[model samples]
Target: MTNDSPKPDDDAVRARVIEAADRLYYAYGVQAIGMDTLRTEAGVSLKRLYRLFPSKESILEQVLLHRHDMWNGLVERAIEGGEPRERLLAIYDMLARWFDEDDFRGCVFINCFGELGTTTPRVAEIVRTHKAGFQARLAELVAEAGGPQSLAPQLAILAEGAQTTAAIAGTNDAARQARQAAEVLIDAALGPATGTAQTRTSTTVTTARPAFRSRR
Candidate 1:
């Protein structure tokens, strides 16, 4: 794509604003930045900022969308060059690299979920769609790789939790734990022989373990 930046125009100004906003959110936190600061950083007038993003919430939503696209591209590229089982590992491998990055701050969607509040349903919907797509992709990869059918969803949940936990922990050690847990889950769900996945179901009464309660 040709450069849309460095021009004294709307797209240029907006792109700069977005880049600054991205940096602010990644460096600080989403709620920490405001429109005025972003405008100043972009060297654009208030009118231009509004013309680009309408509102602070709108800008934040775009920031999330930007993040989603970038990450999705990474995932798609990884998925493109792997077999089903290898593709599953590709996700973890990607996370491993991300965890090693000094500025890594976990999943942006999760962070945005907390920053989002109840501003716009549309923004919320976008976030939900991204997450749902990721989980669905995980499920598909698991099925393709011959993992246990019944546990795909459960494993997805576990992976999300691990991502959140690793972000909070902000350490390579935490990421390693997530990776190992993923392997164990996969091992328990070793490749099925049949062409289709076999889902197991059983009725059992069980109490919730306090350790397993959601932190959110």
Candidate 2:
């Protein structure tokens, strides 16, 4: 006699592996972790793991996709109910929260790019796409706030620079410093704030709480 039970679907199994791989990759770096370790961490058979992700590159691709979703969600939450200028500044607020996480290491895309970008074209493309998406988002926010188009890239640079600085310096102060610089840039581009923008800036600068876990 054979006992029958429903097995988890491929999507569920794939998600589990991606999640486990994400944790290991972020903690140990992608090049350092091997398939056997992933099998143990994911609690799936080696054969099954190979079946789900034919190669390590395949798994890394899925991991980056998952991280993209998380990054988008974080930005959306940070800018949720604010006016255009407030929304622009809110990006830094979100960064401040992320920097404060105990496990924060830095931007995962940047990290992966440094590790495999030169040799791995696929990995390089993914990292570029993620960064481009962020720049586009900042452009939209700047336009909405009636600021010059040039201001968006400047703001993006600050955010990107802050991530690297905070990670290397082992301090969360980078975010606050970036936010302050952003205020000056925004004012320069769009002129002085007349209404609630001033109030929002002061409040957001002082009252950031932990928003999400850093995947990297």
Among these predictions, the greatest lDDT belongs to 2
TM-score of 1: 0.76
Per-candidate TM equals 0.76, 0.86
Global CA lDDT of candidate 1, please? Answer: 0.67
Pairs that collide, model 1: none
Put down candidate 1 lDDT per residue, 154-179, tens digits, no spaces: 66676677678778887656556666
Q: Which residue segments of model 1 deviate by more than 4 Å?
A: 1-8, 118-120, 191-216
lDDT of 2 by residue, 124-175 (tens): 8888878878887888778777678899899999999999999999888999
What are the Cα lDDT values of the candidates? 0.67, 0.83
**lDDT of model 1 at residue 19?**
87
Error of 1 at 108 (Å): 1.5
